[model samples]
Target: MKVLVTVKRVPDPETTIRVKSDGSGIETDNIKYVINPFDEIALEEALRIKEKLGAGEVVLVSIGDSVVTEQLRTGLAMGADRAILVGCDQDLDSLAVARILAKIVEDEGPQLVLMGKQAIDDDANQAGQMLAALLGWPQATFASEVVLSDDQQAVKVTREVDGGLETIGFALPGIITSDLRLNEPRYASLPGIMKARKKEIKEVAAADLDADMSPRLTINSLEPPTQKEAGKKVETVEELIGLLHDEAKVI
Candidate 1:
């Protein structure tokens, strides 16, 4: 079984984000980058599946420029067999990203594809579903648990929905978007880090994929949220109620 996992480069959750002065985007300078947390969980799940089967490959794929190689190498150190970096410097929206990934999927023909339900930076949870639609494959999103059949022909995924948990089954050659609860990612061991230095990271220019690179959506501007006003102290519950009704307008 070959599992293809999509990895995304995102700002570290702990890092403080500063919007660019021109309102174009966030300032990238002096910011730390890491694999999207949800994508890391997906990669971990792929590694665990390979380890359990004792015979399989876990491949990582990301779309970005040379800078993304750092995150790819980190994933390699986490036990992925190899990586493919689709080189593109321009920002791509979810649909363009999905088209590129679909092209790669066609070329690789992996039995399963795993990726995060959403990227932290944009929070646009559309890629996985769009990719699935492009490939006409079954998809399970927000997956908290995934089980593969002995024959490796089918899979069962338990996912989180608005109401509660939902379990669904699908055959191989499908897509699963992992959620936060899927699994905790492991750190790269010293030996693994050393080995990653030798692992192959193949780069393919995005233009060669023949997928439409045009972005359907555009970011006009980015700005930080306005700071909230400080709270006021009240003498009693009556005062609080009055304030809520008159000032906050909740009552």
Candidate 2:
């Protein structure tokens, strides 16, 4: 089994986010970058699957500039066999990203492609589905658990849906978008980090994939959310009801 795990480099969730002065994008200066947490879960799942099989490869792929190599090396340290950096520094929407991934998928011919359900930065949650569509493969999104069938021809995926869990069986050579509960990602040890440093990271230009890199959406501007006003205290339930009915317009 050959598994491809896609990862994303994102601003550290714990770090404070500030908008650029020109309303272009977030202020990246002095901000820390890490692998998307959900994507880390995906990489962990792929590593576990490879370990279970005892004879397979787990390849990590990501799209970004050279800084993204940091996250890719982290994934490698976590046990990915190799890493590929799709050198795309320009802003790419979900569709363009999907197209690039689809091209890589076609070239690599992996039995499974594992990635996060959504990138936290954009929260688009569209790439895996679009890649599946382009590949004409079955998809299991928001997967909390994935188990390979006894025959090794299909995967039983447990998904986290709106109401509850749903299980679906998908044949090999499909795509899976992992959810938060999929698995706890393992940390890279010192020895693992050293080994990862020795591993090769191949870089390919986004245009080399031959996918259309055209931007479908353009961001006009970005602004921070308005600050909330302080709440007022009400002396009586009737007063609260009156406020809700009139000022708040709930009623």
Candidate 3:
């Protein structure tokens, strides 16, 4: 029943994002950061699973700059027994990120790993899959519901698909990517916050993980989409039809 929950720190959803002046990336200077909303759901799911089992530990893992500790602390306050900071400060693709986590998995053997279906910033749902593939473990993506066997040897996961939900069962040592419908996340209480400060957090360097940073993808640049002006409204249906046939070219 041991669980490892992965989290990420991203700019607060309420914050307005400005593209960098140099066109490299977004300007994050002095911007407030918060736990990724999707990862919050994953943490909630892992907490629930641990609480249900009432016997196993829940470890929260995050790979980012030193600022990511805030996000990890939030998870610790929510009920994670411990935290692991991979401490990869710079930007990394999903593959490298997955490699770092997989190294942590090798060091601390956990039966289950849970993560967000995708990061809000990149919306790239590749980390969990990459980790699972690298570890050669079964993976269930976009999971909404999870049903574990009596002995906790296997898991039946329900995931949302194009039209309906699909259920798949896999053995232990599996990875699952969570969706928004998983569960509601809770804010840490004062007592919980104090307890989090005392919780054990093991910091490891990128070298310790032996993770390669060679990126398979590159970000050319980011720019806003083209803006369109409002079109004049035609009062009569005939006029609208004429406009559609001419300027609009719908006809």
Candidate 4:
């Protein structure tokens, strides 16, 4: 079983983000980057699956420029067999990313594809579903648990929905997007890190894939959210009720 996992390099969650002065994008100077947390979970799940089967490949794929290799190396250190980096310097929207991934999926021909439900930077949770749509494959998103059949022909995924947990089954050649509770990602050991340095990281230019690199969506501007007003203390219950009814307009 060959499992293809998508990895994304994102700003470290602890890093402070500031919008560019011209509103084009976030300030990247001196920012720390790491693998997207959800994608890390997805990679971990893929590694676990391969380890359990004892005879499978876990391939990591990422779409970005040379800097993304850092995150790819991290995935390789976590036990991925190899990695593919789709080289693109321009910022791509969700649809463009999906198109690129679809092209890679066709080429790799993996039995399963795993990725994060959403990217932290954009919070756009559209890629996995769009990829499934383009390939006409079954998709299970927000997966918290995944189980593969002994024959490796089918898979069962437990996902989180608005109401509660939902379990679904599908055959191989499908996609699953990892959620927070999927699994705990392991830290790369020293030996693993050293081995990862030797692992192959194949870079393919985005233009070579023949996927449309043109972004369908455009970002007009980005701005920091407005600061909230400080709360006011009410001395009496009647005053609080008046504030809610007339000023706050809740009533």
- TM-score of candidate 2 versus the correct structure, residues matched by position: 0.92
Question: Model 1, 121-226: lDDT tens per residue?
Answer: 9999999999999999999999999999989999999999999999999998999999999999999999999999999999999999999988779899998999
lDDT of 4 at 56: 91
Query: Of the candidates shown, which would achieve the greatest lDDT relative to the real structure?
Result: 1
Model 2: per-residue Cα lDDT over 71-130, one tens digit each: 999999988899989998899999999999998898889999998999898899999999
lDDT of 2 at 114: 97
Off by over 4 Å in 3: 228-251
Order the numbered candidates by TM-score, best leading.
Answer: 1, 4, 2, 3
Q: Rate the local accuracy (lDDT) of all candidates.
A: 0.96, 0.93, 0.89, 0.95
Candidate 3 per-residue lDDT, tens place, 55-120, comes to 888999998778788988888888889999887767799999999988899988999999999989
State the weakest 10-residue window (summed lDDT) of model 1. Answer: 213-222
Model 3: per-residue Cα lDDT at residue 176: 95
Residue 14 CA error for candidate 2 (Å)?
0.5
Error of 4 at 118 (Å): 0.7
Model 2 ranges off by over 4 Å: 232-251
Per-residue error at 167 for model 2, in Å? 1.1
Query: Which pairs clash (backbone N, Cα, C closer than 3 Å) in model 4?
Result: none
